[model samples]
Target: MSSKLANPSSDRGRVGMRGLRASGAAAALSVGLLVMTGCGSSDSAASSSSSASSSAGGEHSEDLKLPAGWKHAVGTTDFQGIHAETKLPTTVTDATGASVTVTDDSKIISAGDGISSTLEALGLKDKIYAASKDSTSPAGKDAPEHFEYTKQTGTEGLLALDGTLFIGDNTKRHGSVAQQFRDAGTPAVVVDDQATQSEKLQAVADYVGAHDAGVKLVDSVEKDMAKAKDTVKDHGLQGHSVIQITATGAGGANSVAGTGTPGTEMIESLGMTSVGAESGLRGLSREFSNEGILASDPDVIVMAESDYQKWGGEDGVWEAFPTLKETKAGKAGKIIVMPDAQIRYSSPEIGAGAQALARAISEN
Candidate 1:
């Protein structure tokens, strides 16, 4: 029961409004996607060949050359194996059409959770000087004492950091702040959050001069994804209809995860069917009404754990939507609660999210 991919334009109006509010007018105005291109070549070939040989012969190789205690810092939530490499200076074309160059020793300020996670994976957490309050990445959460976390830090705060490079989604920085950074000689690279996971990882890696680490992380995530799919198949939960809703205020703002969206991708990858995708909704998520939920009648209800807690957990959800009690999911207690960070951000942790979903479905 593989789910059909939904058309992206099914609920354009709803998704558009959400996107505009999340990213801002300037980012919404940007049309083309950002491209990350390498400028110089390092001894990557030699290093890769050596690593391949060592692994092929069943020998352990210290290719990543990770610093002591770095691996533990990354933790087991989404620990992709490390790969060592030399840093190279490169230029990246951001979503806003701004080109920013990065070097090995650049002082960086991460403004988004997605980029912050990538930097942490590359063992470059110490390089970050500041981040936004919305950043839930390991580096962001454990941000140093000197790091600042705010919704919008304004130009003065950014200038005060004196960072050589700024990495974040376009929504984090307004046009004037971006220009101010440029005027001050510190270039800002605003990544497209809607890009594929691999692209986002590569863009962040290229900006931070950690190409090998990025590749390894992507590979590890891909491998874990394969295993997750197998787990879903083994549990006989393929094509299970799932609907994810977020509890916003009293009414509970319903948004359907459509094709290409992180939630849809994660659900589909686990061999489950996203009701939102099946209905031809796409692009992040679209506002869904109570009528829509009743019509879809999903087999499973997925919501953020925080949202669940806010809604007074399972009992609260049932009380709010008695119609859910009539659905197969509610009758069987199939509501799955996932962390907001795992479902919201396009990071390697998505693999973990998929696994968690599969486990929950199996248990149920």
Candidate 2:
């Protein structure tokens, strides 16, 4: 029987609050999303195009150039045939002096923009798997085979693999599979991006990598950002207080937002500030205090389209948050449904979020 997508709401099952708290705690304690730079800075050439370009059949043939500490893990995984038509580095050196060769085919399991976008950039789709049950593609649904095993009964039973091009960890704020790897003695490669810095996005990546499909599912968030840069710059939302709110999910946190998330990044990119960002520095939440909302008095409100629908759609948030209706943005209908991906995951969706914010701001 083919497995179906699991709803995020009922995903915890009996593990409920304990699991969430564990996940949350685990997410808080761990660190090192990127060995080097912050969101705005570039680590190394390898950090950007770790995949080697130019394949046997005119595939991604771009030269693979990485940083000093990162090595390529080629032929390590079972990437038998898939190749890209771009120039990617064939190898990278890790911090431990381990040399990893870039394989023509690497198993990519993404929970964020870095993993999926990277794989998509190289045009390698067949090697992807799901360590977690979360959907990688925004519009398209994922299958069971794409899942990563983040939630194991004991840390000992964690999935094992030759190498992983990992992104995000639900258990780790960096979203890396390092701890799980430490438990299992599995050697894994981490590709940290801006999204991985966010606890929510990182945890998803951690879930995907633990499933042992880390390399196959990598994303290219930089590329996505590049694509949306023009859109954000043109919109000119500078000096605006933008707040991102979504409908309450199964957890029931409404009018709340996440910190260090793509939404926050989008707001920053547009020269806007996230209203209650400081209070929302940890886990994702929707408990927007009325006073907090009033204090923010944002100029714009943006949300994922589906999330918008949860509260009877865009109309619902407006109706429920009466004060929002009185705001300049609310009155002007300055609401937007971000591209499907941005609302779902914080990974590569930053670009989409920026675009959505830009559009809403410009239009409003």
Clashes of each: 3, 85
Candidate 2 lDDT, tens digit per residue, 1-364? 0011111344443332222332432211110010111122223333231223212111111233322322211110112332344223335433233344433234444444334533432344444543444443521133124443434433232254333444333334323344454345443344332334232333323333221222322333333444445555666545667666655421435545555455666566556666535444343454444433443456666665455445653345655565566655666545544433444344333443444345445544
Encode model 1's per-residue lDDT on 186-206: one tens digit a residue. Answer: 777766655776677777777
What lDDT would each prediction earn against the true structure? 0.55, 0.40
Question: Where does candidate 1 clash, by residue pair?
Answer: 63-84, 64-83, 64-84
RMSD of each: 14.1, 16.4
TM-score of each: 0.66, 0.53
* Residue 11 alpha-carbon offset, candidate 2, angstroms: 43
TM-score of 1: 0.66
Worst 10 residues of 2 by lDDT: 28-37
- TM-score for candidate 2: 0.53
